[model samples]
Every structure is written in C-alpha cells, then in structure tokens.
Target: MDDDALRAWSVSVRYPGQPEPALADVSLSIGPQALTVALGPSGCGKTTLLNVLAGFVPPSQGRVTLAGAPITGPGADRAVVFQHDALLPWLDVRDNVAFALELQGVGRRERHARAEALLAEVGLAHAARQPVWTLSGGMRQRVGIARALASPSRALLMDEPFGALDAFTREQMQTLLLEVWRHSGRRIFLITHDIEEALFLATELVLMSPGPGRIVERIEPGFSRRWLAGEPVRALKSDPAFIALREHLLDTLARHRQANDKETA
Candidate 1:
C-alpha cells in the first residue's frame, strides 16, 4: 500500500484558557513502512501532536487521516508506545504483552505464544516472567515496545519512547528499535526532543516550534541504517549536520519565545 498520503493535517489543539493553542495548524506525512520522527524543543507540542494521532486527545480543528479515511477513535490498527512503559504493575512482561490480545478475547495459549515472540524481538524474553515494577527502566520500555508489536497495528506512534533510559541503555534501546522497525516495516510516528535520536532513527525529520506548535521544517536524514546507527551516531553526536539541525530548531524556539515576550511587553 502507498503510504505517501499518510499524514497529519491542519491539526490544532487548544486547552481551556491556555492563551494559545498547544498545537497550531500542524501538518506532516508518513510514507508507508517509513519511520518519521518529529524533532523539537520541549513543550513544542511533540507529544500533543502524537496524542492527536493516537486519538487520546481531540484536535480543536482539522482532522487526522490515514490513507483517505478519517480516524475518529483509537482502533486496533494503530498502537502507541509512550515515554513511560505504562505497563500494568500487576502483570509480568509476557502477560502485559498478551493483555491487548486478551481484550480482543484471544485465548490465553495463543496470546502467550505471540507475546513470547515479541518479547524476544525486543530482547526481553529472559525477563518475560518478571513483574513490570521489578524491571529496570530500560527493561520496562522494551516491554512497552513488545506489547505494541503484539498488536496487529499498521502504524506505531511513539512519544519519546526512550527518553527516560540511561545513556547506555538508551543506545541499546535505539538499536533494538531499529531492528524491530526493519522487520516490522510498519509506519511510525515518533516524537522526540533529542536531535540525534530523531536524525538517527527517522527516515524523515520534522522540527516543531513551541505552542501553538507548528511544524517548522522536515528533512530526510539521507543516511543508511548500516552506516549511521548505534555507535556511529554517537560518534557523530556533535557533527555539523546534527549541530545545524539543532541550531535551526533552537532558533525557531527562540523566535517563538521572543514573540511571546513581545506580546506580554
């Protein structure tokens, strides 16, 4: 299927008496099986935009559509992974993965089997029996991804999915995510504040400014997974291209702040 049309359009969100919309008329597209990352400063509506796509929050204006159809509510076809693992404390890793399936009334034996495969994919099979709270920070995120994968979703929406991990664990999680994406080839909408993280994993990079947030730019990183991944990205963590992207976003954020300042002045 051609996912060229998979995109966010004129999406705007405003909370009650917030002075301005949390998100402006923002729009962007995701190609099928192609990973798209939104890079921006904190409070730039990165997560809010992701929430709209996930149907957690409604947009004040405009619509979010996949292909030609409008998305009204959360469906089995779209699965989300938030920054926090958001796993059930009572359930073990495998059971957490199976929980989504259980809701659909899938029997225990089959869901457990599928959950095991996904856990292995994220390198958490060894910890499958462990309770969520007992796992390390990184382990919980892995289980989150595993649970998302277990669903039959055509698209994955991740909001800073590894922001909470330690440096070492974060790198490992990044590698694991790329491997999973390579195998799954599901369309992804990921939101992150880290420029390197966005450039490293995304086929396309989107930069957004603060509230009322709007996409300021979108650029393809134009590098391959084999060359621009794992340690290599860390090595180029401060490379000029990365630096340029960072500065560009910072500049936009600064401008927004200045405008707000002037409004107050």
Candidate 2:
C-alpha cells in the first residue's frame, strides 16, 4: 500500500444559501489497498465527507488528490456501492452486472462472460438469470457489490451499503464484504452508522462529530490480518476488546451531543 492514494487537505463544504458548512476543516489521507470506515450519527456529515472523496460535491476550500495527482470530477478509477441496489428491473443479474461494459459498446458475448464470472464470485451464479425483482434485499446488494467489483477500479467507495438489511442479512453482508475486501485489496472507503461493522471492516476508523463535522477521532482496531482472514467474524464481534471499543465510540458520540446541546443552550 503506497502513500498518496487519497488525500483531502483541509476540505470544507457549504451548500448554497446554507448558514453552516456540511464539513469543516476535515483532513486525512487513505492509502492504496486499505479499507477505511467513516462512522457518525445522522446529519454528521459522514456521507458528505464520502461525497467529497467520491468527487461529488466539491469542497468550498481545499482539494482531494489521488496518487499525488489532483482528483477532479468522477473517474473510472473509483467505483461506488451505494445502499440502494440501483439495479435495473428489466435487466437480469448477469445483464445488470454487465450493463456498464455494454454501455462501453463491448460485445454481448464478452460482457456476459465477465458478468457471469463476477456473479459467481459473489455466489450469485445460480441466480444469474433471475429477475432482480425476485431476489431478496441481501441478494440485490450483493449484485451491487458484484457490479462494483466488475469494474477495474483502483478504489471502492461505499455509503452504508448494508444499512437497509435485516440484522441477520446485515451480518451476512458484512462477512461477504470482508471476503471481497480481503481478496480485492483495493482501497475501500465505507461510510456507516454501525461502529461494530466499521471496526470489523476498516483497517482505519474515521470518527466524525455531529452536523458541521470535523474529525473527532481516528483509531485502528488493529485486527490481525490472520483474524480478518478467518471465517469466524462472530469471534471478533464477541471479543471483549471489540465490545469495549464499541462502547467507547458510542460514548464519544453521546458526549459530543451533550456538549453541543449545552453550547447552543
């Protein structure tokens, strides 16, 4: 993992006619081949920060760069997995995965082949021909994951991609994500409200404050590569260290809220 992958230098953003910035003076860099998670409460600028990284809503001040080169607009080098499946109902699983390639005018044969391979990777091989309307919530999200993986992107940005799933499905998606992340080894920036999920997935955690956000904390769970490689994600989830870490972060958010309320009052 080389340095200078993604760096946001003193970035800040204010929506037109808004009194306060969505994000103010947030600075950090993500290296190549790492999974980073941003965790915060609602309206805490968590997604806004990701929008900056994904090149959607440019910051009013400062800029973001990739590989020492300034990042402008969106590029194919970055792929995003939004919470919504965003799959076309008319398209089958394979076709949905291949849609991007087809848009580039690739031959149907080659595109379908590539799509099948990605579907297989995500355990959706049998569902390749299934209508998206028939698939479950988790299945659709896996399709979204496959679609992102289908692209040869240098980085992956995910915004609470599992937020809508039931608890069981959410856990399953988390494990699947870890497997894909371990295999792809591409830089992943995941925005989430789940502290436990963030710890389980991210090599580094970025904690943000409430609205008009700034970096409140940065910590690494330091889960060993061996642990992440193992199948027992539940072990990590149940570990005392993990529980303590979760409590600490939740407490941190509570304190921020209390302080902010007092300041305003």
Candidate 3:
C-alpha cells in the first residue's frame, strides 16, 4: 500500500436549495496505517462526507485528493463497500468477487485465481462456487469485502458495512476486518452510529454533530492496535480504561446531540 493519505481539505457540501450546508469546512486525513471511523448521529453528514471522498459527490468548496492528485471523479484507487452487498445475483460468489478485475480486462484464469485467494483469506473459499443469493447476510458481506480487495485501491471507504448483521455476526466481522487490515495494510475509513463498534475498530475516530454537520472531536483510541498486538477482543473491550473512554465518547455525543436538538426545536 502507498504511504500517501486520502485527504479532504476544508471540504463543504451543500445540496441545492438546502438552507444549511450538509457539511461545513470538514477536513480529514485517512493515513495508510489508520482505521478511521466517522461516528455521528443521524443527519450529521457522515454519508455525505463519504460520498465526497469517494468522488460520488463533489464538494461545494475545498478539495479531496490521494497522493497529491485531485479526485475529480471515482477512481480505482479508492474502493467502497456499502452497507448492503451490491453483488450480482446472476454471478456466483467467485465471479462476483472477480467482477472488478473482469471489468479491468484481467484474463479469466488470472481473475479467478486472485478471487479464489481473496475468498480463502476471507474464509469463503468453500462458498466460491455457490450462488450469491444463497449466502446469508454476513456471508454476503464477506463476499463484498473480498470484492473490494479485488480492486487495486489504496484505501477502503466503507459506510456502515456491518450495520445489517446481527450483534454476534457484527462482532465477528469486526475481528475479521481487523485481520484483513493487518494483512492487507490498507487504510480503512468507516462510518457508523454504533459507539462500541467505533471505539473497538477505529485507530482514529472523528465525531461529528448536525445542524450544518461538522467534526466535534477527534480521537486516537488504540484498541484496534491492541487487538492487532494479540490482545483478546473481549478482554480489551471490557477493560476499565476502554469502558471509561467509551463512556466519555458517549457523553460527548449526547451533549452535541442535545445542543443540536435544541437548535432545531
């Protein structure tokens, strides 16, 4: 992975006729070694910020870049994994994972070989030949992640990728994701409303508030690093220090939410 960061500099977004900007002077840097999470309440512009970074939505002001080059539109350098799996129903798991490679004109044998390897890494090699529709929700997401890896992207931009899974599955996926990050060495930027998930997965967390959505706080939690260093996930999550920071983040979010509520009221 390139050491360059995916960056947003003073980015702001405004939809037509909307009195308030969706994001106001937002800035973020997703470094190569970071698992950055954007945590916020509803309407806090997390998704909008993601879109801008992904080149799906251009910022109304400021700029976004990777490796110092401006991002005018979506490129292969940044791959996105959405909340819901966007796999092709007609394709089996392996082909779905190879789809990105196929689009890039990779030969059949090569693409399949690469796809199979990724499937195995994600613990889905056995399901490679199965139809995507036959896979369970969590299984499908594993495939989604596998497909994202099929691209040559330097960073993965995920928007609530595990939100639809059950609690148990979500936790499992979180561990799986950490494993993937450790092995792939790819930067990850995720958006979520789940406090524990943010605390557990993020190397750096950006907390945002609504009413012209903007970042309220930035944190370096270090829990994901602890997990990478062979600490048990359960033990780390239950540690008093971890719990205390979790509570502090919760309080900060609540205070911001209350202020936003009063403003809108």
Colliding residue pairs in candidate 1: none
Which segments of model 2 are wrong by more than 4 Å?
1-4, 224-226
Question: What does candidate 2's lDDT look like per residue over 111-156, in tens digits?
Answer: 9999998888788999999999999999999999898887777888
Backbone clashes in model 2: 0
Q: Indicate the TM-score of model 2.
A: 0.95
Question: Largest lDDT belongs to which candidate?
Answer: 3
Q: Which has the greatest TM-score?
A: 3
User: Model 1 misses residue 55 by how many Å?
Assistant: 1.5
Q: Candidate 1 lDDT, tens digit per residue, 52-88? A: 8887888899898878688887888789998877899
The alpha-carbon root-mean-square deviation between model 3 and the true structure, to one decimal in Å, is 1.5
My TM-score estimates for the predictions, one after another, are 0.89, 0.95, 0.98
Show the colliding residue pairs in model 2. none
